[model samples]
Target chain A: MTIPVSITVNGRRYDREVEPRLLLVHFIRDVLGLTGTKVGCDTSQCGSCTILLDGVSAKACTCLAVQADGASVTTIEGLAGDSELHPLQESFWNKHGLQCGYCTPGMILASHELLRCNADPSAEEIRHGLEGNMCRCTGYQNIVRAVRDAAETMQGGTS
Target chain B: MFAPQFDYYRASSVAEAAALLEQHPDSKVLAGGHSLIPVLKLRLAAPSALIDIGRIDGIRGIREEAGRIVIGALTTHAEIAASATLQSGATALSEAAGMIGDPAVRNRGTIGGNVAHADPASDLPAVLRCLGAEFSIAGSSGTRTVDAADFFEGLMTTAVEEHEILTSISLPSGSGGQGSAYAKFSHPASRYAVIGAAASVAVADGVCSAASVALGGLVPAPVRAEAVEDALVGKALSAGAIADAARCVGDSLDDDEVLGDVYASAEYRSAVAHVWVGRALTAAAARCG
Candidate 1:
């Protein structure tokens, strides 16, 4: 049986009927065509499906669309508000933070939540914050640098 | 991987959830979806229906009532980790909460789901055992409460009946001259404890007056380290004293009962059990006022 689900993605509200088995990641990618959110492990092990649910980073692969029926979702496509590029997005590009780029979307979204809570997170804090999202390539040194740059820029250039 | 077809209901209240369970015989309570979703994806167990109680707002906050700290079942691990009350009053619980899975997992996993699913390696059971927390379960008949020791029956099994839902868990607020801590050797991949230990101590005049200790992750269910507790009751709680008492934790385990697999052997887990127990005791004793 299908049930009615109303969710606000990015800034627009979309209402649809979904199966109880449909995962939130599928709803974001398949139903809404927000394909930027990639599914990595599908078991919630690899944080490739991370999204902000009601302003908190959660593994979309591990949650059902119905579970988030009345909530708001923010995916990678929505990260850069009105700006042409969010600081994290720009730093990732300049620092060459992506090798395969498959893990980049989840990495950026997860890092966004971490930087939101802490504007001046140290290297260790950034590493610990993004532990859920995994990158096969890059070895995380440049990812850490990109997040550090974004944090400095967000805090008005402490660098 | 998609979960199998199942009817869904978003319960408005605890009573409604219980009633839904009664109406739908094979229905399951869906909380944070951290545990259940993974199981469903694996096709381990498929229920006919799912009663989504995630929106029942009344069962989702942490509060202090009288002298006890009451945590609604819907309270998430992130909330518990960030709670000032838990951080100051029940430091061990907060520490364990922070050590659970990575940040995103902590954000969505609820205490009730973790407790009800009752994975032996999960951290909260051991902390609850150390703190002597009580669980409140609601059913069609009414609400009933059980002690932590009795609430957990076995691995992935609990005292919550099929028709019931856990509403909240409560424990005495931290007392004077008391401190508690949880320590674990995390399995590098899964992050589940290889051998977890929780210690709560009361010190007075440079001597240990009372102590409660529980061990998890290595055993089938969380067990109280009574032998360790007995050895510390009258000791000075010095580094050496704590080590000597913590070693007695061996007496509480049967060599044949420890869990082992390709990740960690039973012998290895038994050998390091006291190391974590000692670390927990040392840290807990340091926090004692």
Candidate 2:
């Protein structure tokens, strides 16, 4: 049976009939055609499909589409406004945070929540906060650097 | 990964959820989806219907009620970690909640769901066991409260009946002078506790007036360290007293009864559990003011 779900994705609303078993990641990629959120590990362990569910970071792969009905979702595609890349995306590019770039969207969104909670997090705190997002390519030193740089930029670049 | 085909129903209230469960015998209650959806995708469970209780209004916040801190069933681990009341009154629970999977997992996992899932290796159950928390369960008949001891029955089993929903959990307040801590030896990858211990102590005049000790991840279910609790009460809570109590942690269980895997052997878990229990107790005692 199909369930009717209305979700606001990247600030746009789309009402669709989704299977109850349709994961939010599939709903975003297949239904909405926003492919930036990668599915690294289908299991909950990998943070590759992370998204902001109502401004909070959550694993999209584990969340059913119906569970997000009427909820506001922010995907990697949503991070960039018309012409400007998000500070996190820009930092990832500038700081060499991505090699495969598969984990970039999830990393950026997860880091988005981390910086939101702790604007000026220490390196240890940043590592702890991004424990959910894993990148096999960058070895995380550069990813850590990118998040640190983004924190500085987001904090008005005093550092 | 996609969950197997199932019909979904968003339960607006507890009664509706119970009714849906009655209407669909193989229905699963979806709270946070941190545990349930993963189970669904793995096909470990294929419930025909999902009663989504994530949006249920009455079961969502933490508040003080009648000398106790009553936490709604849907209160997320993130909320628990951030709650000042929990940090001060129930430090063990808050810390355990913080240590679950990671940041995204914490934002979605709920204490009620965790307790209801009753994963043998979950951190919150051990802490809840130590805190002597009570679970409020709602069913078609009515609502009833079950003590933590009676709540977790066995591996992935809970006192919550098929048609019932755990609505909230209640913990005693006035724990300012009491100290509580949770210490765990977690698997490096999954981060699930290999062996975890939680202890709560009320120290009066440097003596342990009241104490509760519980252990998880070493056995089929979270178990109260009755011997440890008995050994600590009325004692000075000194290093020697704690060491003596720690030794008794796994005395109640046989070696074979404890869970063993490549991550840790049953013998190793039994041996290390005492150390964690001791550490948790010491931390709790140090927090007592």
True contacts kept of 2: 0.92
Q: Which whole-number lDDT from 0 to 100 does residue A106 have in model 1?
A: 92
Output the lDDT of residue B42, model 1: 92
Tens-digit per-residue lDDT, B1-289, candidate 2: 6668888888999999989999999999999988888788888999999999998989999999888999999999999999999989898988889889999999999988888999899999888888989999999999999999899899999999999999999999746569999998989989999998999999888789999999999877788898889988999989999999999987756677799899898888887788999999999999997
- Candidate number with greatest DockQ: 1
Which parts of model 1 have CA positions greater than 4 angstroms off?
none
Could you give me the TM-score of model 1 versus the true structure?
Answer: 0.98
TM-score of each: 0.98, 0.98
Residue by residue across B1-289, what tens digits does model 1's lDDT show? 9888999998999999999999999988999999999999999989999999999999999999999999999999999999999988999999999999888999999999999998888999999999999999999999999999999888899999989999999988998899999998898877888888999999998899999999999988899999999999998998898889988988999888899989899898888899999999999998997
Give residue B261's error in model 2 in angstroms. 1.3
Query: How would the docking of model 2 be graded?
Result: high
